[model samples]
Target chain A: MSAPMDKPESSRRQFFNGTVRGAFLFLLGAATTLLFRRSQPKRTVWQIDPYKCICCTNCATKCVMHPSAVKCVQVYPMCGYCKLCTGYFEPEPISLDTGAENQLCPTGAIKRRQLEDPYYEYNIDEPLCIGCAKCVKGCVLFGNGSFFLQVRHDRCVNCDECAIAIACPSQAFQRVPADKPYLFKNREHQA
Target chain B: MRRMLRACLYLTLLSLPLVAAFGVERFPPPEFDAGYKMPVTTMPPARALWLSYVDVAVLVAALALASYLVLKKRSRDGVLALSVFSLLYFGFYQQGCVCSIGSVQDVALALFNSGYVVPLTTVAFFLLPLLFTLFFGRTFCSGVCPMGAMQDLVLLKPVKVPAWLEHALGTLPFVYLGAGILFAATGSLFIICEYDPFVALYRRTGSFGMLALGAAFLIVGIFVGRPYCRFLCPYGALLSLVSRFSKWGVTLSPTDCIHCQICDTACPYGAIADPMLKDPHPDPRKRARRRLALLALTALLVVLGGWLGERLSVPFSNSHATVSLAEQIAAEDAGKIKEPTDASKAFRQTGQPVEELYAEAHRVRGRFAVGSVLFGAFVGLVFGLTLISVSEPHERNVYDPDPADCVSCGRCYVYCPKEIVRVKRIQGKNVIPLTPVRGEQKG
Candidate 1:
């Protein structure tokens, strides 16, 4: 049955609800304004700082994305184009041939082609690259350090906290402006 | 002679500053006579910044529509349709990143770390739902939140959890929120986002453990409505607090209650409060005594919680990478461990003083000590308040939706005979009383 409540009591409850609602609204407004003022106007996306990367291979497995957004990038201008390209061939190979067993990249992402009698050009097959940083380690160690890893924005969902960042040994992952998502190795130091 | 020369070169390369050698060019590109053109490395464009704004716009529109459908239209069908759209757009399409649930960490990080600049979209994602909950109750939970919608869509044969069990389990979100904030503020982790069950499903790939967690929640959701929303979502804890003071909320019946108790069973979340027949404790003196006792118990709980939390600081501090790294390095130096972890090797390669790393770790642990104490105290306060409120007498006179627990999913609308009559009357159908009038039944 519909029980009749005293009008004053009902009105008092309404007044209390109204007062609380107003107070809550005021608090929310203050928080919103403060947060908005503190926030950056520009949006950010996760990127990898090429310089600080230690090629620990954490990016290959730790990313939330299956294949990871990270891929090895080749800087052609700084390439030595050596016949025994360290980045393309395993440390000790039977012969410097394009054999799967001798390839430095587990996924065979690095493609080696002869440019001249003594020079060879290495290209990265982005789709095949697992971001394991194998070739990057090789290049950095013995070659011209032309190979490095970068987060491909198209494949990246840009999680608020990048899983790979947490797993990174060298703390190389960072947030860069959405407008400039990728960090490239500069040629200034390469003479 | 060649092998010896190679050995000498290797030693020199190793001896050189390895960090500085990263971008060094020992050999230049070979000049080509065949006019070979170098293919430029292509950089993929990031997700458009305007798309993030569009997501915010969609969120606002969905929340507004959900509130209207829940409060004004009181249409369950409309709310369900909206929930499906939210599931697709926010859950599947956007892949559950930048969600309000995860945005809690972003806000915490931004507030504590001056270096962190939370994006405008993230702040909007964090605050908009709370603002709406203050005015319109948790309409966001009803049909707008993808996580809620994911669970809502999976619900089948719902089973009621025991009130005592529900109350105990309900405290988890607050504890989780505390840990999430503590870790995020300290720049340690985003535990909420890291442990998010549904995000793995949305992204279609994750660590096997995460995928299993998502699957478990979905399976559990089939029998228990919105398990994540009710017991695990930190954002829901915040929304529930705001919704307690909400101005307007979903009503069980459009007109008046018939005391049918149909809405009580209709609610999968058990959010409908039945009318009190009479006061449970009529004696005022006994009531005051019980209240005082409960208050004392609450105070004790708060102290115990805080003390326990402080004791946990050392273990909790290990969650921070630097602290764990420092410990690892110490263990290595002590010969307790032989192999250096990748992190330790990287740290050593930086040539930073071990003492500096130890000092940083100490500073972080100090922050965690303070943070854990506050976290424990906050959890204690929530538990104490919950106990006090549960014991408090209610003045409710009708089958009213509990403002804090009701998701405003509009499930109870059709169950109310009064609501059914109103719907039929609106359709211009010849109305027949579905049940005998309450007054006539006694006569």
Candidate 2:
């Protein structure tokens, strides 16, 4: 029978073997250490970067949730506060009235109120909003892009694999730290 | 066995038309109705968090079972049963989400982006298999992994890859691993998950390209034996590295090897290394000199690889949305283009200054430049090591399993005479003692 045990190693060869094994151990330890060091206490949630979002309407249908968790949020600081707000009004509204036909939001989710002379404020009704991004598209196309879509944590089921994120045409969906969830687009920075 | 072969042949014949039917479009055109009402989009009842917990429990249990079967039981049938169970549960039932293989990218991206927090479960998924491999060799690869299981099931005729070609092609997984990390770290893409061949089958819907690629991999798997796992799986490459330093590895026989050569033929992955023979050679000093020369050449290759990587970064960076946008804007500014893409139009509508966009793109490109060079250096190192290893001679005394290649499939157990003898002894049957041959040893 062949030798059941390995041949006796010379001291130099033994040293070489030890060194190689040591190197491998060192690398494995380093990787594991680095991974643990980088790990966070809490996981992040899906979010949308408004600047990267092209106002695609897939948010309305791609989600398994009816009337998707994706909701339009407004950054008030960036709002121009225009009387004829493109986001609130249709392309060819009969008048600047808050009628369902005159409004760009198909669900009449945007509540228009006269804040001041030639200025109006629009608030989104979360229950009614369908996340079509029609108003977002309008605002981005003609206004200061104050209107944007965001994943509402309360409404979101936190699917391990978010369907909207997968079907997102522009790949706007990303993970954000739960503590500071929203990826709000500030005037000073790009997404 | 002949009856089983006949049954398989009949099954194949019966399924032939069904296979051809996938190509034909059978749906008729929908007729319009004026009174047609839009179907109300109802939410499917959300799966409970408990269900997700259950999936994790199932995964852990299956992994434990697979390890036990491979290390203790050493039963091929047990391994095959576990593989089928894993395939059904993980691949078909769970629809292939939150996979350990894909979690590699998530971990990589999280490591680079401090702001991005990878899920705790994802971290568990990524590390569990690796830790298992470190202790028990590749028990995870034996049957636990759905991707491996899927490929293993379709292995009809596994042909041994030519030694030279196998050595050369083996480096691809390392390159793929490097590229996967570089892209994920730079926030460019997730090539590993994105190019996953089997995920589409699990999900039941995907791009035509991915579906075709999946079909192709399966067809090649019939003869090539888990092509993706062998040549393209980044996670497999990582597992192989850890398995190299595993505390324990697979043994072919229960008692002693009779050198029957049956187990060698049984291993589908070609992971069995024969007992070593003494080399009749002279000039040890010359061999050392040649190894030194190869080491120097390896260093030179690394430098060249890093340089080439940096040089190609500009075009490579275009895969990033911001970089592509900047290029388009630059072209537009120079009056070289007139058309505006949907993204470009959206960018314009956002009213962000073009300078800021360019700056972000430039930063992203700079990150890619650094990442790609590192990626190239990593690939070069792997290539050099592969080159060195292929020529390295082994002095193994017994016909042992190659730690880096063996998946602990347990097929060897079926053909081992010692294993058969042990089983017969357990069953209380008459057995014959056979002496192992020494002179008939190959090499």
Candidate 3:
């Protein structure tokens, strides 16, 4: 034998190792089953807390869908109702016309309607929106931060792991329960 | 043992009521106004209580099959089939979350975060394989692990890394495990799961950088043969350490070794040890004396490493979100940063006390300091062991698999002549005892 071939000592070590392994397994098994039982009703849906979003333009590219499910939503109460809406019009628009060149949304998802004289109401066309967050950034910077991104559940495949959540830079994506999924940035939202 | 089991049962029972009490609360009211017609809500499919149990059952079955194939059957083909199944179920079907590899972080996080209740699946994923490995010598690694399976499938051009280079590179897993625990314990991130290469492939979507990293690992695996498992998998490091004392293990042959060297080249992972009967070094007594001194030095290094780690904990603590936020708030206060980012803005709007945030950061940093000392000691211990194992080479009279390194892939069985004879004997064929042929005996 290369080393001491004490059978009793070797057997003792094996017994000790086996005991430790058994004890660990038993404890882990208990904890695991408890956790599983506890997690039964805990279903989570992917969502964005608009207040935490950094508008990094990742929502457009990182989403698995060709046209991202994330869409820009207008918080009407938070809107300043500006006639020269920074979100609807380009940064250096020649005029606030209905021309494509003057439109801020790359896909023309934001529709500018004159509610009254010197005030325009902007509504997001969800189907046309790519969630690039360009308008959200523009609005947040220059106007009342009314425009924000939210995951459109209608189009979402509900993947086990959200693609955009993994890529989100500011870690804005969260898993809120299915019942109250959207963390909308509204007038009531403190932040 | 009975007492322990009873205590565990009681504890689990006691915790159930608490779990139910804090169970899913009422969902908050709708964000939109009464006049606004909410879009039809598409909830994630209700996770049935039985579904999680099904996953657990599948996992248990797979482990059982893997152990059977590896230890009893010794069929590489069976192992491969299991690997393919694991790749399909665990990798593609489940999308690689709650994996044994990722569970390392969950366990670490739970240990540190007393309030954090680890998901049951995470605990199961972490332990079952380790338990199997302790008994059956890394049977889980052979085929059951989706990460290993993915890499195994891509092994096209196998190459033998130089022994010294392999030894040096093998140290990386320990460092990786230490860093993983450090990050998780500090609530910095689950870097292991975040960087898991095969997970992106399973999901069929992720950032370009992560996708590229996954592709790069697979490409490297074509030549390196489970390079991630050997050099980067923190879980693999844990398995390897525990597998050293495995009760049952793989053998190169069923019977005596004929000193044939074919099996030596068979193992892609370089787990086979080529025995040398003679002492390679002169002055055995002197070497023994030197070894004792080295052991003392290793002990010293462990203590010194812990001290150094404690000193460096502050910088390491920056990875934690609270610490980073605190530093950012301080920077903004000092007018060092011109503009506040979204996180800072959100924090300011929360109306939470800045002093409380600072205290939280301080507390996290203090924990990191303690965590770092343990991490440092672990690293130093690994370093000392590596040096000592190399210095005190064991005498081996026959070719054998190194228990610590062997993944039990069963590649060596086919190369062994005795194993071939045993197979023939089992199949009711005439078994011939080895007698040297005239030409072969000339040497």
Top candidate, metric TM-score: 1
Q: Between the candidate structures 2 and 3, which one is better when assessed by DockQ? A: 3
Q: State the displacement of the C-alpha of residue A21, model 3, in Å, after optimal TM-score superposition.
A: 4.3
What total of clashing residue pairs does each candidate reach?
Answer: 0, 0, 0
Off by over 4 Å in 2: A1-191, B1-47, B254-256, B280-282, B426-430, B433-443
Model 3 RMSD in angstroms: 13.1
Candidate 1, residues B316-398, lDDT tens digits: the string is 99988899999999999999999999999989888999999999999999999999898888889889988988778777787
Candidate 3 residue-wise lDDT, B293-336, digit = tens: 88997898899879888888999998777788889999999999
Ordering by lDDT: 1, 3, 2
Residue pairs in steric clash, candidate 1?
A: none
lDDT: worst 10-residue window of model 2 chain B: B20-29
lDDT of 3 by residue, A1-191 (tens): 11111223357777887787776567666756655543334545678877667787889986755578788888776776666666787877897787999988999998887654445667888889999998987676555677888887765644434667756656688887756667766555433
Chain A superposition TM-score, candidate 1: 0.88
How good is the docking of model 2, by CAPRI class? incorrect
- For A1-191, candidate 2 gives per-residue lDDT tens digits of 11123334467865665565566667656766777777655656778888678776888877645678788876665666556667898887898898888999989998887653545666778789989999987776655677788888776656444667756656688876665667775555521
* TM-score of B-chain for each predicted structure, in order: 0.92, 0.86, 0.87
Ranked candidates (TM-score, high to low): 1, 3, 2
Give the proportion of true interface contacts each model preserves, from 0 to 1. 0.66, 0.07, 0.06
Model 1 bad stretches (over 4 Å): A1-9, B1-23, B433-443
Worst 10 residues of 3 chain B by lDDT: B19-28
Error of 1 at B82 (Å): 1.1
